[model samples]
Target: MYVAVKGGEKAIANAHALLAQRGRGDAGSERIGYAQVRDQMGVLVARVMAEGSLYDPDLAAKALLQSQGDVLEAVTLMRSYRTTLPRFGVTEALDTAGLASERRVSATFKDIPGGQQLGATFDYTHRLLADELTTPELPTDPLTPPSGDDAMPRVTDLLGVDALIEPDRPDDWTDPDPADLTREPTVFPMSRAERLQALSRGDEGFLLALGYSTQRGYGNNHPFAGEVRVGEVEVEFEAPELGMAIPIGRIELTECQMVNQFVGSADQAPQFTRGYGLVFGRSERKAMSMSLVDRALRAEEFSERRVSPAQDEEFVIAHADNVQAAGFVEHLKLPHYVDFQGELVLIRQLHREFEERVAAARAEGDARAERRTKKEDSHA
Candidate 1:
């Protein structure tokens, strides 16, 4: 008796239903509210925003809950949702100088203007495990007042006093809206914006690993975070038709300034240069790693020693995306019988050739024995 299996479509539908049920486990239990996710799971939301390229914490939180806390999946869902939203207009270029800073620190300066504000950070927090978060009201500290003149020249700005690094000025600001990496294919010799855009949306785990390799002496390059700032930067879009720049909105941005010490070569002078990194939301590690990787990418330009994984622009940037890498890696689960069959055929053919060669050798030996026996008989 033989049996044939059918109902492929039905199987897939059933599997999807099961998955949905599993994802929304125990509907009778307290449904995870969007606010709870946004406020409590801010870290996950931050990751989603950083990777999704969307800034709405509420949407990001919803995506996280719907995707069962799978950050990459949440990001994927958020990105799909973000694309469905109409692109009415671009926002104005955000001035970092005008950012409502939550956290700001400079490693390169002793005391720069607009003193370092370590706002809302877990930097110095003890890592002791807490037994319970069941307290009715969480303890909180009063929010620090904003520093006036918000425009404290960045630490890099202070370096110019001794002619070390380039000072930040209005003239240094570049146009933002003309380049949209999401809508276009990446071009060669990428701009800083393009690189940051890529890094911002890149897979966190992959980028972290690559960044780790660089620090572990895989590239043997030294780097310091000149500054890391997390704050809300106003996004301004210029409506030339409107005859003025309009403020569309603001986004929480984490920007990193990496300063690498290098002896300048032909195209550049013997002074400190800058490597920048920016991401949506507060991802300090990602931003700092991005800065290091960014500087490492300039190995050819800076004419520095190039022995690090970060220096390999193609390898680092190409593999930095978790979504793409994950998809490709998991695609092996799909049917691959055709390729397997081809390999099987080659193996069988090789086995047959080996057997034939052995049989021929045995036959030749038998023939030689018969000829010798006849010669011995003739001699007898």
Candidate 2:
């Protein structure tokens, strides 16, 4: 036991030292700065913020540096830091219609208002990695503001005008007080707000897998990208003392609107259903995956059969958190001597019982043979 404890302590100390050395990289090379990570690796910082449920880019960058660029670790760090900060107030619902878009596109329509502005996207780039990017000189271009009208109407709204899609109902907005999952524990039959909050902070890779599963006929709902917009939107807070809303600041957002096909049910007519996704920063993949999952979770509302894991709310939300999943999975590597000893004791008892039963059966057989021999001798 002393050896086990000493060995474990020494091993952990060595592991930590190795990790620190690896995180610093080559001694001859310059160490990576948090500023460089924040500015150059904006996408990674954005991911940490989204998954961590915190919007501070600087904090996210710090977390990334501390975690050695492991996104899940960075997210955990940010989340831990977030708990120390006090809440000011909740922001009012954002108006995406008035957003100053950097990039906007729709797969369902060929041309829409504001046109398809594919801004700073990797969509057209080749998959090959360019080693030149290590110390590359970037080209400087004049900032060209988006031309035409700034108002980009939602594709779903256009469909709604033609009665091709379900109209946005007032009942959807009837939830006065939404549950805060951070403070309160998640209960069964979660509200839409709670589900969205969970998904926004969920691990992107897990959501991507589940979303892909839906596309592969698991919970097939022919979904199309109605609209994907990435841009800056104004955030406003309503103060009770002021009795009015006040603009706080602007935040970059990625919003996705997915139109899913739904057949006519007994209570409702056939119409295109909607799945919404909104997240911090420019995350198209995450937004799209989130929308697919959002629709899948609403199978009951659509009167569709829940035949897939995506439709299982308990499974999806419970396992969506990487921190929680990692803790439970990694805990297996810890000491389990007591647990194993209990199992060992039970196995020995079972083995002994089996041997005793075998010995008793053999003795009984010998006695029967002896009795048969005695009867034969008496007859002779």
Work out the TM-score per prediction: 0.83, 0.87
lDDT of 2 by residue, 166-278 (tens): 76654466746767888999998997778988998899999999899999988957899999989999999999999999998998999999999988789888889888788
Model 2 clashing-pair count: 0
What is the C-alpha lDDT profile of model 1 across 1-380, one tens digit per residue? 01122557777777779988998789898777989998887767888988888889999998988888888788889888888888767765566755667888888776777777877777897978889866355359754635665456677766777988644433568665667767888676776667767877888777777677767777644667788988877776778789788777777888888876766678766777777778888788888878777767767755667776677766776788777787789788777777999999999999999999999999999999999999999999
* Error of model 2, residue 47, in angstroms: 1.1
Cα lDDT for residue 156, candidate 2: 87
Estimate the overall C-alpha local distance difference test score of candidate 1. Answer: 0.77
Q: What's the TM for model 2? A: 0.87
Candidate 2 local lDDT, residue 222 = 88
Every candidate's CA RMSD: 4.7, 3.8
Report how far off residue 279 is in candidate 1 (Å): 0.9
